[model samples]
Target: MTSVYPYLPEMIASFGVERKDVAKWAGATSAVFSVAQSLTAVPWGRASDKFGRKPIIMTGLFCTMCFFLAWGVSTSLKMAIIIRALQGACNGNVGIIRTMVAEMVQERELQPKAFSIMPLVWSVGSVFGPAFGGLFAKPAERFPGLFGNSYFFNKYPFALPNIIGGVVFLISLSTAMLFLKETLHSKRHSRDWGLILGRRITEAFKDRPFRRQQKLRRYSIQDAEASAPLLQTDGTSRPAKAGREKPVAPSMSSVFTRQTVISLVSYTFLALHSVAFDQVLPVFLNYPPQEHTPRNTSLPFFFSGGFGLNSGHIGTIFTFYGITSGVIQFVLFPPLCARFGVLRCFRVCVLVFPVIYFLLPFTVLVENATTRYAALLVLMICKAFAVIIGFPCSTILLTNSAASLSILGTLNGFATTFSALGRASGPALAGLAFTWGVKNNMIGAPWWILGFIAAVGSLPVWMIVEGEGPTAGSSDSSDAESTDAEEEAVVFDDDDDLLDNLTTARRGSGREQQGLLKKGSEDTRNTGYGTVR
Candidate 1:
């Protein structure tokens, strides 16, 4: 995915697209991918909730493999666009993977360590993907000794890199299939692979006419116990008897408290501005320098223009940035987050974004290539670090803000959907801004605009009040469900109503919250309501 950005012009040109329209076409291609993500994210997340994370993840990887293979073979611009969109539509694994990480590692204090791996992986991929795309693309032309006159390479010039990408996904899929554990608590009890397979086969054959030919033995209570026996009160296992049954836990609802809503909105704003900046920065870095004119002679090449670099040079720079990002995320971020606390660190990082945005466009001032590259490496590292630090912090906040495990998938889905919308709009708008600024002899206008937007993105952070982070072994699922309900009720009830309710709750010796909790427990037991979570 990161590879696609640096090679946009080459890919666009292969379809006989004109040079002037390259920016527009590149923006459209990127936009369509996000559009597809926006449409499918929610449904994929919901499916994962119903089934399991591994299933959805594997499905996504399979689709991506197919998409990459198809992309390599595409003959037209429209085919490439369709392939990209298909990849996005089937690639809603981000949220589901986050959900898995959250579930697998529950302690809030340790969450930074766990979540840091995500950005590290991304950084590594971002570093190598561009290098591979830039160096190995159109292999028949680039590496004549190896691929010249080879029928496959001649016919599909970009096949080598794309095939390598597909193979990478294939390896990931195989590793996941072999080693990834199912983390869903609800499904944990029935996780015997044999039983699962048998159940699936039975279901598949139930409606077939051949199924009626054999006398099928009814599943006995002993079989149920053998498959998934109930847990004893003493943390041991025992077969469930007739009358006594454990009460089902409460499901998290879609309705969010004021804090969760504010945090989500803040995240959306930050993502919108950040993505736009990312899209514009790469394009600007590779653009040709503006010619000197009498009226525009005052504008330094550094302030209002770019350091003219080709695709390969730009990819190398990004590779360095990615390396720096990996070190920061792995070695730097966790301690900073632990020391300052997640919310405070998030605030500090977000506030620094505008500064990074403003400073990035000034790298053109250094005339020497080595000095210019060093300056950009430092500036870009700082910028990437800020975002890397804030992103996982924001995710932790979202997960902690969620009501319970039952609705975790839904919350992450919502977050991804909003992010997709932001990403979908960002590239096109930023590209348009860049195109317009360059046309009007105001090359720095886009940077100035992006910096201002980033500043605006920081505003919503103030609305999210911090709370105590979840601690290890403090509350199990049931207690968490009840406590989250109480907190949500106290925090989100209207201000006027809150005062009255608090007074009433005090008069009842704080029994009001208990009553609400009890009522919720009863609803869970009586109705077994399966939806809304």
Candidate 2:
């Protein structure tokens, strides 16, 4: 996205729009994409629950391919907007993929490790995508020695990046088709072949015979009776009562407890703040230092307050950020999570956002280029750390908050929908805010606004109550207490049953009963406790 930021003015100008409206159109275009994504994220998540994770993911990949192709060939800003929106509508895979990862790792303790893959993978892609866009975009124009006078290159100067992006998506789709596993329990038992062709052929061969032989098994009361070996009954006394009843688990409705609600709200706010920051940063960085006088040309440049970087420069910076982000996600995050625990780690990360935002504008104050770059790099690292930390932790907490395993899909879907809302609003608002700040000659205004948002967003994190321990999600407190009480009561109940059976045996034999009674009385006197007697 940063790669394309440098070209937005050019892209907009080709549509014959006024220069002043570029920011507005940029924000609008991004909003359209988010709006589409917001509308479909929940539905896709629901579909993943009903169908399976792999299929949903593959569908998203296919949509991404289409999106890139169309975006590359776009003749006008309107086409780009529609294509982007289409892509968003079709590619609602974020939550579904999160669900897949959570389900993939059964052991609760290993989940953090598994979840760390997501951010790392995303960072890697972020690095590559912008690099591709920055270096490959407008290839016909930029690389005339290679693509000069070629019909394809001449007709679609900016199509090279899109073509590469599409191919990448295709490769990803192929990989998914071959290696991705179905994590949904219901879909798991249905034969999976690890590769598309093998699965198809296997299903084709199995379908006829499988259906022909399929028959429902019926339950039998006789089977139940045969399985239960009878306990002896004493005629001298009544039959022993049953053991204590087992504890019932909490209902699905119990998932919406105060802690869970607070976590969700906090997560949504975090998303809003994080995404807004991300959207604003690139624009701020690419913008030239503030200009005192109007220029003859309408090309984009940083004003006095901006970084004044080209697309390639911006891409290089993002590449650096991405590499560092990957390291932090994979190497640093797990230990941090282990050392500080997920909630504390998340809270600390949240607190860092405001600090990062506040410090970001200060980079412009540095007079030396090298010093400014160094300072900016450090700030970017901190920002990446802040951004990456909250997501995985929030995902863990969300999974933990599930009322039942069955409802994980629904809960994540709801989370994705809320997140989509934030994503949709953030970029648009950020663009507008930056534009407003620049036009009003208050360059720090956007930063200040963002800082406030981050600070306010952090407040909700305090309300999230961490679970007791690793086994916290297994059951609730009331159920645990009930289970303990039931277990304690079972010993007496078993003794009563055994005593009744002994009494029945005594009743059957009169001489034996008298002898046994005498022995029992002697034993009871000696032990001063009930036993076989």
Per-candidate TM-score against the hidden true structure: 0.77, 0.74
Candidate 2 — worst ten consecutive residues by lDDT sum? 217-226
Give candidate 1 regions above 4 Å deviation.
Answer: 1-4, 192-255, 291-295, 298-305, 468-476, 479-533
Best candidate, lDDT: 1
Cα lDDT of model 1 by residue, 363-449, tens digit: 665567788778877877778888889889888887777656666676677777778777767777776777776666666666677
Show where candidate 2 strays beyond 4 Å.
1-10, 13-20, 193-256, 291-304, 468-533
Q: Rate the local accuracy (lDDT) of all candidates.
A: 0.67, 0.66
Clashing pairs in 1: none
State model 2's lDDT: 0.66
RMSD of each: 13.4, 14.0
